[model samples]
Target: MITRILLAVDDSPAAMASARHAIELAACLGARLHVVTVVPDHSLSNLVTRMGSHPGVHERRDQAAEAILDHVVRLARASEVEADAHLLEGDAARRILAEARSMHADLIVVGRSEGLDRSTTAHILEFAGQPVLVVPPEVR
Candidate 1:
């Protein structure tokens, strides 16, 4: 009964693994995939300015987010699953949860990294109204 699946991803290996799982699941369930990656909101830091690395930081982050989303979307399409890409900026967990709610997703999928005290997957699980699948890196 999972017609819509929202997948939150990043550049981590775990995220890529989760993407693969999501693609397969969507294909099996005849579901559409909503793929999203967040560009973290960065606060101005004196160190960054002093180091002359602040100028392209936002651009680079945005590009990276786009790349991640694009990769996932391509994978989903190659698997014959319909996919949409969303590039968001702000707190990762908050944005992801908001996107899921906006899309009325039937399920949420995210990757969990081992040994992290607090993770986006944890936050999404704590707040998501729908079922969430947490894929570990070793799954694939």
Candidate 2:
């Protein structure tokens, strides 16, 4: 029985697919869904200096996270599963792994780039200490 699930979501088709799949699996297994969205803290436009291009970048990222969370919530509700969403800041892989450990997640679902072949898949496979379900973009 999967009691808790961590769905790593981002602004990508593959992530959306992963979220949907996680919701379905969680609902079927009577598991609670936890959506984690991470935004890079030091991206190009988010230099955090006077010359940064957009001052509202963080706000925009937050809004995007909120929107994505809302969508996940709506999906989970439709599936009759309890769901919680969170906005985090950090590197993608590290944040996902840390959240899984912190929240005691039974499974971690992530969206994988289709272009990455076996090598990348192996690399990701080695990173997760828990079961990881990597959904490709086509599924999203």
Top candidate by TM-score = 1
lDDT of 2: 0.80
For residues 1-140, write the lDDT of model 2, one tens digit per residue: 57999988877788888888898899889999999887777564457635755588778778988899889889998999999899888666677788888998888888775553334345546877778898877721
lDDT of 1 by residue, 26-122 (tens): 9999999999987766664334666885667666777888989999999999999999998887888899899999999999999886665147678
Model 2, stretches more than 4 Å misplaced?
114-124
Give each model a TM-score.
0.90, 0.85
Against the true structure, candidate 1 reaches a TM-score of 0.90
- Candidate 1 residue spans exceeding 4 A from truth: 44-54, 115-117
lDDT of each: 0.87, 0.80
Candidate 1 residue pairs in backbone clash: none
Clash pairs, candidate 2, are: none
